[model samples]
Target: MKMTKTPIKVRYQETDQMGVVYHANYLVWFEIGRTAFIESLGFNYHDMEQEGIVSPVIDAHMYFKQPIRYGQDAFVKTWIEEYDGLRTTYGYKIEDGEGNAAVTGSTKHVIVKKESFRPVSLRRVFPDWHQAYSDAYKSEE
Candidate 1:
């Protein structure tokens, strides 16, 4: 499986009074990683948005391994976990300076029409995008 890594600098504002990174920040990092992953596959999310199609997260989950403080080197590794035209699941791993996993998460999303927010089969809506996802699809063996 191919994974895309995106480096994220921990910012002071992203921390709480304890100086630990806020939990929500991991989700943001996941977004960054997911975007990079899509681009790495030669897909443009903005173009999809322009075409009145959007993929919205239906579920999100995270497992925190440790707290990350400001000024630490961190990066998110992302890969396509599963895709079956109707829904796509992306897996994420956030690592700290020493290459230890700080957080692991997954987000599931489904393509929908921007106007009505109605679900649409990716294969029926954007065949090329669907095929690309299928070509890179991954799942536990």
Candidate 2:
């Protein structure tokens, strides 16, 4: 399976009064990881949006193992956890540059028509994209 790694330094602005990263910032980092994964496949999401296809998250989940503070660097590892006809799951791991994990999570998404919001199966409508996903497919199940 293919994976994308993104390194980010936690900034003070990303922290709350507690001095740890704000809970909401992890979601943003997840997005950054996902976007990097998408680009790794040689597809541009901005172009996809212009093509009238919108990939929206149907589900997002994360488990926090440790608190990350400002000035610490984290590496987000992202991979396609699974891809079926109409849905795709992306898995992520936020870690200290070493192997210790800070959080493990996944996001489920489906491509939909920008105007109608109806799900579109990439396998049939866009075989090339589906193939791209297949090459990196992963599943814990």
Candidate 3:
């Protein structure tokens, strides 16, 4: 797998009274990781939007392993776990500064036409981007 790592400094706003990161904030981190992965592939979500394509998360699964406190530096490692013509799954791992996993998750998304909200195949809209995802996913096997 070709993993892209994005470093994040846990901000006070992301934590609770106990100083542990709020559960919902992990999903935001996942978005950050996902955006980074797409950018790393030489494409970006903004361009997709401009082309009238939108990718929305259809499914998400997360596992919390450890607590991350405010002021801690963490990293989100991301990779393309699966990608078909229409649906793509991005996997993510949030690790503390020491490389210990604090959370792991995956988000599945499907490309859609921005106006109609109908599902569309990435291969049809962006062949190069689709191929890049396929190549990256196959590289792990």
Candidate 4:
């Protein structure tokens, strides 16, 4: 499976008095990774929103493997773990400078109408995007 790695510089504001990154910050990293993944495919979220389509996260999960400290360089690795016609699950891993995973996560999202918040199928609204996601998806096998 191909994963896009986005480099991140840990900032003091993202950490606590203990110098360790706050747990919630990992979610932000996940988002950054997700955006990078989408951009890598030549698509941007702003264009989608302008087109009346938006994807909202329905589920989120994270596993902390190790502590990340302020001033450390980290990388977020992202990939399409699964993609169906209506939903997409993205996998994420945050690695420290030494390439050790500091956190692992996944987020599930569904496409929706930006105005009404009504669920929309990617297959119906964006066939090319759907096909691209399908092609990038990694199956359990």
Candidate 5:
């Protein structure tokens, strides 16, 4: 499977008084990972929206395994877990500097028309991108 790893440096602001990363910071890291994954595929979310398409997350879930502290470097590994007609599921794993996993997560998103917010099949609108995602995933699309 093709995967992209985006490195994130945990900032002081990302931590609470306890010096551990705030709960919400993982969400931002997920977005960073997603963007890196998209860029790895030679596409960008901003450009996709300019092309009249927008993908919005419909479902998301994250599981925390270990605590990440400020000043620690984290690695977010992202891959396309599934891609069909209108939906794509992305999976992620975050690891600490020691290569120990800190979190595991996945997000499901659907492509829609930017103007109407109606579902659109990426296979029909952007066949190359769709095929790339499909080919990257191992399971049935």
Candidate 6:
């Protein structure tokens, strides 16, 4: 699939007394990776929100492999793991400066109406975006 790699520097404030990056910070990095992936596809989440469409995470899974210390540079590789009309799963890998994976995870989200929070199909709201995801997934095969 189409993947986007984003470089991030671990800030001291994101760590605990032991200097290891907090587990919760990985979720934040996942969000950053997801946003960058969408933007890479020429889509702006801000515009989607303004249009009354919101994508919220419905499920998440993370596997920690290595500990990342503060002040180290890392990279998050993100891609569309799967996408149906109503839901999309984004996969991520956080790698340390040496390219060792620190964590791997996936988040599943569904697009909904901001007012009612009713689930909506991305294909109905954004056909091009939906098609782009399909194309990327197929290309991987």
Task: Say which candidate scores most in lDDT.
Answer: 3
Give per-residue CA lDDT, model 1, range 67-114, as digits (tens): 889989999999888888899999999999899999999999998999
Name the lDDT of candidate 5: 0.88
| Colliding pairs, model 2 | 81-138
- TM-score for candidate 4, residues paired by index: 0.95
Q: Rate the local accuracy (lDDT) of all candidates.
A: 0.91, 0.87, 0.93, 0.91, 0.88, 0.92
Model 3: which ten-residue window has the lowest total lDDT? 132-141
Better of 3 and 5 by lDDT: 3
- Model 4: per-residue lDDT, tens digit, 1-141? 557999998999999999999999999999999999998888889988999988999999999999999988899999988887998999999999999999999999999998999998899888888877877774332
Q: Which regions in candidate 5 have their CA more than 4 angstroms from the true location? A: 139-141
Alpha carbon RMSD to native, model 3: 1.1
Candidate 5 C-alpha lDDT tens digits along 31-52: 9999998888788888778899
Which ranges of candidate 3 are over 4 A from the true structure? none
| lDDT at position 78, candidate 6 | 94
Error of 6 at 28 (Å): 0.3
TM-score against native, each model: 0.94, 0.93, 0.97, 0.95, 0.94, 0.97
lDDT of 3 at 86: 91
Between prediction 3 and prediction 4, the one with superior TM-score is 3
The number of clashing residue pairs in model 2 is: 1
Instruction: Quote the positional error of residue 118 for candidate 6 in Å.
Output: 0.2
What TM-score does prediction 3 earn? 0.97
State candidate 2's TM-score: 0.93
Q: After superposition, how far is residue 17 of candidate 4 from its true place, in Å?
A: 1.0
